[model samples]
Target: MQEAAGAAGEISEFAGPSEEEELQRQARAVAQPDETEALNWTMKKFRFPLERLLNYRRSRLAGEQARLEKLLAEQAGLEQRRAALEREERMVNESLRRLPVISSEQLAAIASFRRFAASEAVRLAAEIHAAAGRVAAQRDAVLSARREVEVLEKLRERRLHDWRREVDQETERQTAELVVARWALSRESG
Candidate 1:
């Protein structure tokens, strides 16, 4: 009976070391940093502020996009008007070309017709010119709005990148601190 008890004690001591070794391995595994910690740090550092900025930028972009769309629509309308005016001008020129050569009496009547046609042509030309101006103005407005949105987007991207970099740097620092703490704890335990 005494021999059996002694043998049991020896086995228990051997088991203890193995149990301790397994515990140490588990501790080492737990001490290793995970990607989740880095992601958490980034979110904590940047998400709130970035969200605020993003909201403001989104609102501004929405407004600008709407304005640009409206301007483009106006430009399309103006272009259609200008095209119609050009077609009318072409038809008028063709009619003038096809008209018969006139005698003196016919000349007076033809002169009055020519004068009236010239006045109509001038009026159509003015309308076309005005439509062209409006189209150009609307196009420029849309372009300007687009440029503004692009600039804001670039700024937002830069801000997000800066925030991400800061979070990454902080995560690296925390990881180093965690490693040192784990090393000290292990040494103390040993």
Candidate 2:
């Protein structure tokens, strides 16, 4: 937040007052969901130089999160596949155990089926490992993007807070000036 403020302040050294209508409009825009915090009567236009960057970071965060979800879905698919493979392997083994080894041909076929099931189990394990790695990578990306968005949001809130403070000070100064002017008029009339 401080970084954002410094960047904005450096970009525009010549600070000036905004029009009343513009200030009121921005104040109204900020009022939504924060009626209590925004009850400062008015607020100045809180412009941040890094608004575009903040928006881009937010978008990137969404994209990263989506990718993480996709990776998780893939992992779930791999788990389902492994479970199905285990069921098939168990069914084949049970059938073989129940069947008598009467013919050499039958024994050879059973051995081949067992080998095939083992190979399939190995392949599935490899796929699961790969999916886990991808999911971990995507999760890291999502976390980094989330942090970026958080920082930007905090900066925006800080800028708004500062703007409200400025508006309050300005309002106070104007009120004092009015009071002094009225006193002078009364003195002159008397």
Candidate 3:
């Protein structure tokens, strides 16, 4: 009986493998299974790489958004400058408009033969005519400058509109690319 009990103790101590070891072996078997075997998995199972791709896309989108914001800021500044210039031009035009109109009768009287015999009168008339000519030339110059300002303002507005449209298009394209990449990555991961 002593010998048999010693033999039983030895049998119990001769463990083949632990439960933990068996489980580890089974896990390895499943992990390295046949490549042709289909895995009943979902996209959620491989979210790490998919999430990384999405983050990259988000970063790219952020850069584009920043660029667009900068463009918008520049456009706003240009518009503000244009507005200030327009205000200044309007003030100048208002001042010009308030000036008295020269009458035909005044011009004819200034050029009349009665003043020809008097050297002083003739000199005064000539001076008055020169002053009128100078005023007319100044008015023309102001009108020409105002027209140029208007043309430049219109060009700026057109360029801003075009830039806005381009930014919007780029944003949309990035969004589409992000969506497509996410879908493709998810499919590949699954």
Q: Which number leads on TM-score?
A: 2
Task: Name the lDDT value of residue 116 in candidate 2.
Answer: 83
List TM-scores for all candidates, in order: 0.50, 0.70, 0.34
Q: Tell me the spans in candidate 2 whose CA falls farther than 4 Å from its real position.
A: 1-43, 100-106
Which candidate ranks first by lDDT, i.e. highest? 2
lDDT of 3 at 153: 56
Task: For candidate 1, write residues 59-90 as lDDT tens digits.
Answer: 76677667657666755665576566567657
What is candidate 3's lDDT per residue for 90-140, written digit by digit as tens? 675575477587578755754452343255445545655665565555556
**CA lDDT, every model vs. true structure:** 0.68, 0.79, 0.55
Q: Please provide, for model 2 over 15-48, each residue's C-alpha lDDT reduced to its tens digit, 9 standing for 90 to 100.
A: 5555754654444444332566446545557798
Query: How much is 121 displaced in model 2, in angstroms?
Result: 1.2
Ranking by TM-score: 2, 1, 3
Which parts of model 3 have CA positions greater than 4 angstroms off? 1-122
Clash pairs for candidate 3: none
Worst 10 residues of 2 by lDDT: 24-33
